[model samples]
Target: MSQNDALHGDDLEKSGEALIEFIKSSNAESVLRGARGKLQEFFDHHIKTKKTTTDILNDLVHAEEGIGQKLVNLEGKKSQMMQEIEEIEQELQRNLSRSQILDSELEFLQKELERLRDAEQEIQTMQQEVDQDTTEVIPSAIYVAQLYCNVTKIKLELDTEPHILRGVYYGGDVAVPINMDTSTRSPCEVSDELWSLVNTEW
Candidate 1:
């Protein structure tokens, strides 16, 4: 209020009469409780279609509290989500490593198969040459005996061989000792007649 608005005494009679007349015409209420707000056009302010801070439910404060709880929940789950992502990354890396190893193994196997096919073709060609020329043979009696022993072993393991060793074909089953060396049998162990026959045939 201005100095004249709070005129007190008959000493300022004219100012006091003017203030009193203004208060009577205004009919303003006395402020007995808390503080009073500044005068303004209050109707123009709240006449619009919008809620203020003092709305019925205090909705702004409630919404703030709700958002705070949601933020706390999100923060709590962040580490768990990060751990799950790491686990997925590790699994993907492990599978990729295994796939690379499998691809390498398959590549090596294909190359080895091609090499084995070439070796087989070379062996067949050499065998045909040896069959055509008997003079080209390397004659070793010990080698012949070892070859015979190996043939016998292969026939035994085949299980469907109608012909095994020469004399042990359809008769008694020959049981070989497990620990003995089958290739160690010398050509001298054979009878003289069989040795002569082998020398002539071979």
Candidate 2:
């Protein structure tokens, strides 16, 4: 090979080995990172020098900065999402507390409703007894008159008169008569003492 060609080959080999070392090292400054990109551009320029190696290196450096900025933005989004989740969890706890209070009130209301139902059943039984004692029906007027005899402390008597029937009817026609005593008596007079005793009773 010519001396110039040999010297260029040695420079390429040294640049390649330096680039491998830079990539392996964890400590890379922005300038050194840009230099690493410039090495790839330098290789491409040696093959075909349409664009300058420096311009390609600067573009790659800007792209890396953009990627880092996007990572920071994603981290911010993750923090916001975590905060929202915490707020929702707090709301759920508040709702659970309200539900527990409502459950307690519902249980109390159910017990009260059951007590009212029992009271209503008892009232219905008492009303039925009052109705049974107050009213009665009689089969005939004679039976009705007999009931007043027990209540008013007066006796009632009936009189009968017989008449012969002509051929218009085959039986004798009898006239029924009733007598009522002028004097009547009731069980008790209207009095405050009697009303007081009735009102205080169950």
Top model number, lDDT? 2
Q: What lDDT is reached at residue 93 by model 2?
A: 94
Per-residue lDDT of model 2, residues 1-202, tens digit only: 9999999999999999999887777466666878989987888777675456667888999999999999999999999999999999999999999999999989877876786576567656655664587577535665544443333323334442222111111112332222222233232432232222221111
TM-score of each: 0.36, 0.35
Using TM-score as the measure, the top candidate is: 1
As a TM-score, model 1 comes out at 0.36
Residue 69, candidate 2: how far off, in angstroms? 2.4
Tell me how many clashing residue pairs each candidate has: 0, 0
Residue 140 Cα positional deviation in candidate 2, in Å, after optimal superposition: 28
Evaluate all candidate structures by whole-model CA lDDT and list the values in order.
Answer: 0.55, 0.59
